[model samples]
Target chain A: MDVLSLPFIQHAILAGILASVACGIIGSLVVVNRSVFLAGGIAHAAYGGVGLAFFLSLPPLPCIIGFSLFMALIMAAFTVERRHRMDTFIGVLWAVGMATGIILIDLSPGYNVDLMSFLFGSILTVPVSDIKVMAAVDILIIGAMCGFYKEFLAMSYDMEFARVRGLPVRLFHFLFMALVALAVVMTIRVVGLILVMALFTIAPYLTERFSASLAGMMVTSTIANIVFVFTGLWISYRYNLTSGATIILVAALFFMIFIILSRFASCPRKP
Target chain B: MAPGGDQQTTVLPEGQSRAGEVPDVEIENCSFAFNSVPVLRDVNIRIYHGDFVAIIGPNGGGKTTLVKLMLGLLKPQKGRVRLLGSDPAKSCRRVGYMPQYSTGEKGFPITVMDVALLGRLGLTGIGCRFTREDREAALGALRLVGMEKYMNKRIGDLSGGQIQRTLLARALISNPEVLFLDEPMASIDIDGQSMLFDLLGELNKKMTILFVTHDVGLLSRYIKSIICVNETVYFHHEPKISPDMASLMMGTGEKCPVEMVAHGIPHRVLGRHERD
Candidate 1:
């Protein structure tokens, strides 16, 4: 209770909740579209933005947003035009982006930036400005979800059919990728770049079986993500563990338990 | 009713007089390629209103590609494609397309009703919720496909045949004047296939239907014409195919010159090839 009264702890919890909003919504979309790999590429590629921010002395949030968006657009183009070779391209981008980030960070003189924070997250130290950015991003994601819910649902389910219905499938694909970029960047604050994919995928994957609709999945996944974040934060605070890794471990625990229980439930029984 | 005969005359079903007017779908000198490998070359096809066409060919012979071209999902490398008297992209809202059933994204969270309602996506404004009328129409479409009982079921939980029928319901919900189904019969059983054809026959009275399938043996009484595609396009006006034409479709023979006539109860001399 004393920890809850601490301003930094409160900020960390707020950051966790804001991050969950984006995670739940965009994560559901990523899972349904089966673009987890693509999102992973975008998440890792966002490190280029972080390094660029540090090297150029620019703000990290906007730099990461712009760089991740550029990567997302390129990936989206590859997906639309050369789907067969998309994985290869994503692999190349993933490696190149990470290498570029590391090189840029190394080249930047006299900065002494905490690279581990970007990789493994620093939720306890998440500044108020970062919290504001995360909240703004959450608003943008919620607005987009509300406005284009059906179109997204249709596009995600059967892209060709959506195209036949004149739904601008390619445009949606690009828009979705951009949203993924934004979500990845925001999630970096709570879970770091390396662990963002877990936050984006695990909850949605767990919720998809019980959810009968995409909206339902998004809602349930968001709630599940919030639960994971809160529980992970409490455990991390209690044990002085790494918060981001703890959050992901919490989600993974739920995932494994759900999988095992479901397997047992579905197993045939003798009369 | 004859195979390999003089191109059969356009026979309009009763109460339909739109034939010989503006073609419902017209592709002129359409050429498409992938990675410099040509899939369709100089493909010219004109389908009239109320016509039922079956596009059949071997794997990699571009049966699905041709349908995708017509649906504007893929643009031809060369030539113009017009659907419903306009560009396919502009006129797509008026067309219903059921792509070949793909086992995409296992456990994708969507209900049969949700899928059916997606058919009304083009008709509704962006950001708007589906209305009560939309739900009723979806229900009606589901009923048409005999999927009404499973409206609440997740699409991923359904059988292959059930998924196909749900997709068919989605295609039909929009009430398009032209329908394109790619390999829709691949998963359904024999009884389901006949029933689906019977339903399509009833639908043919109001809308033109173009379906791509490898089951040439299932060409029913409703198919008014056949388009044999294999790196090139041949428009057969009759439903039945001669052995020579079948061999041509199989990509194993040169162009057959003789027009052998076989009438009544469509059957195939070719065995079933593996589906892509």
Candidate 2:
């Protein structure tokens, strides 16, 4: 209980809440659009920005955002133009991005960045500045989602119909990808790139089965994410374990329980 | 039934003749291909206002492709497609489209009302919510499709026929001048199909109806014309399919002539083909 009063623990909790805003809203879009793999690719490729920041002695946040946005554009282009080869393209980019980041960090003279913290996050060490950035990104995400909720819904539901309805489908696709990049970058401080997919997908995937609407799904997923973060943080703090890995494990545990329970619950009602 | 001819044998439906009116949809020498393989070749079609058209073709044929062209979803490599006097893309707001039912996203979370409201996307501006009028219009469209009772239900929970109706409501919510439906009858039962055709017949009085179907047997009495597509497109302005036309549509030329006998309104008997 005393750990909760610590400023660092409080910052970690705030960081988790901010990350969940992005995870819940953007995660719903990503899952519904079936772009989990694409988002994962962006998350990993964001490491290139981390490395570039180290190499150039620049701020990691802006560098990661810029790099991730660039990667998202490329991925979006490939998805829109050549959909058949998108998975392969994402796979290639995912690896190349991580490789570029590692090489850039290696090339940076006399600076040994804690590689494990970037790979698997150090949420406990999150600073106030990073929390401010996450808060700002959350605001931008909420604004975009509010401004274009129907557009995003239409696009995700039936893209061809959306195009016929005069919705700029391709433009929305690019914008959605950019938002995914921002979400992924913010989440890196909480759960890192490797575990980002679990946070982005698991809660949304679970909530999607029961929620009646996209907004409902987002709200439930956000709440579910908050629960996961608080629970995982408590367990990690108690056992002195890795926070990011513990959080992801907690999500995986809930996902398994949900699937099993839903399966059993539906079986009895089936004729 | 010839592939690329301007032969006008159309018997316009009663009380719906617009002889000198500009076509609601016009595709001039439009040829489209995918990966250098032609899907629709030198296709020309002019659908008049208030005409009910059934686009019929095989699975791999260009029926859906032709509809996509009219909707400006795909560009023709060789020619132009115009809807309501402008390019298809420019005139899309006045057009309604119901795409082929896809089971791929069956579990997608959306309500029937929300799906129907999506039709107003063109009218609704960015950062603006759907107004009370928009909700009423969506409800009206759902009522027309007999789905108003299920407006609040999740679209994923609907049956195949119900899903089709919800999608139909979505297309109709915009009050479009021309409506394009791709395989609307795919998963519907015979009774549902008949009821849907009745609804479409009623709608044909207000808007131009062009639908793609693989079931040639379900051609409604309201269908004014039939567009048979393969690699090439053929416009049969009459509902009746002649033996020569049937064979042409079969893609077997004169060797396999098929005979069709009209028995009653919306009923036709296809005589056995003579194969050589």
Candidate 3:
């Protein structure tokens, strides 16, 4: 019980709640819009920014945020056309970004950074300042979602119809990708880049089974993400296991159970 | 189920006729291509108000491209397209579109009500909450399509016919002056198709309706005229289509067009075009 009183544990829990807001809201749109692959590319490619920051002796978070946003815009451009081949292009970018990060880290003189933490997160050791940043990112995501809920819904469901309705699809898409980039960067300390996409997708995918609307899915996914994070944190603290990996495992397990249970659920009435 | 009776349709006095009024849709010398391969060339058409028009063409014959041109989803390589007497891009908010049912993700967890309400996006500013009026209009549209009972249901739970109807409600929620439907009958059964067309027929009385379909024989009763597009475009002012005209329009390399007319519509008939 004293573990809950520890400042680090409190920060971890608060960070998880903040990250869940972005994870749940943007994650729903990402999944429904079929932008998971694109998001994965941005998450991985963001490492290049981290490396650039290390090499340049600059602040890591801002550098990575800018770099990831730039990368996300490029990915968005590539995805706007030739959607059939988007996965292939995004895969290429993902590899290139990670490779650039590794090489840059190697070139940084006398910088023996603990790369494992960035790769798989050190949520238990997150500083209070980083939690504030996560809170700000959560605010950004929530504000954007609230302001553009209708546009996001329409575009996610039928893009052509949205375009026909004059919904400014391109501008919203650009802004959305930017928000996704920020979410990915902020989440790096909580789950790291390797497991971030799992956090982003798993809860939303599971919630989609029972959710009847976009807003409902977002709320449900937020609760689910928080639960997964807390459970994983507890298991990690008790068993002395890796926190990020344990969290992903919990999510993956729940996701599988949801899928299995869904099959046994009543077959939805077909039109 | 009597949504039409409960909600009187919005009637625009100036929209009842083509004479002495701006055309609902006007495309002049419009040409388009993808990667240097021309899809539609020199397409010229004028769709009048209160007209129920069907655009028929082969699989890759630029039918969708033409609709996209009018919807301002695509820009013509040459010439201009006007909707409601202005560039379609400028006036797109006043139009409604029901894309082919295939565009829908069947497993998506959106509610029927949410899908229908999306049609009001043009009226309700993006990034804003829907007004009470918007919700009422969306509900009215769902009622009109007889899917009001399923409004709270998940779209993934609906049947194909029901999903199509929900999409129709989404398109209709905007109260558009002109409605464009692309391949609305692609997935529906024969009976569903008739029912959907009947709904469209009822809708046509209040607004201009343009739909794209490959099922030519059964649609004569619902459409006021036909626009045949196969690389080029031709507007047949009458509903009666001859076998020769259908064959020429279809360009399926068959000498005789497969004529499968519905039995009840005796007033409009299509036989061999003896002149051509």
lDDT (10s digit) by residue, model 3, range B1-276: 111123222222122345687898988888899978999888888888889888876677788898989988888889989999998889988988888887458878788988888888878876679889988998999998889999899888878888888988988998889999888877777777777878888888899999987656557476777777778776776665544345545445532233345465434545433443
Q: TM-scores across all candidates?
A: 0.91, 0.93, 0.90
State residue A98's C-alpha deviation in candidate 1, in Å. Answer: 1.9
Candidate 1, A65-124: lDDT as tens digits? 999999999999889653677888999999889889989998898765577788899899
| Candidates 1 and 3, the one with greater lDDT | 1
The complex in candidate 2 yields a DockQ of 0.74
Which candidate comes out best when scored by DockQ?
2
**Model-by-model DockQ, in order:** 0.64, 0.74, 0.64
Order the numbered candidates by DockQ, best leading. Answer: 2, 1, 3
RMSD of each candidate?
5.2, 4.0, 7.0
After TM-score superposition, what is the CA distance of residue B33 in candidate 2 from its true location, in Å?
0.7
lDDT of 2 by residue, A161-223 (tens): 888888888899999999999999988989987899999999999999788899999999999
Interface RMSD list for the candidates: 2.6, 1.4, 1.7
- lDDT of model 1 at position B112: 91
Number of the top-ranking candidate, with TM-score as the measure:
2
Q: Write the per-residue lDDT of candidate 1 for residues B81-192, one digit (tens) a residue.
A: 9899998889999988888887874488888999999999889987788999999999999999999999999887888999999989999999999999988888898889
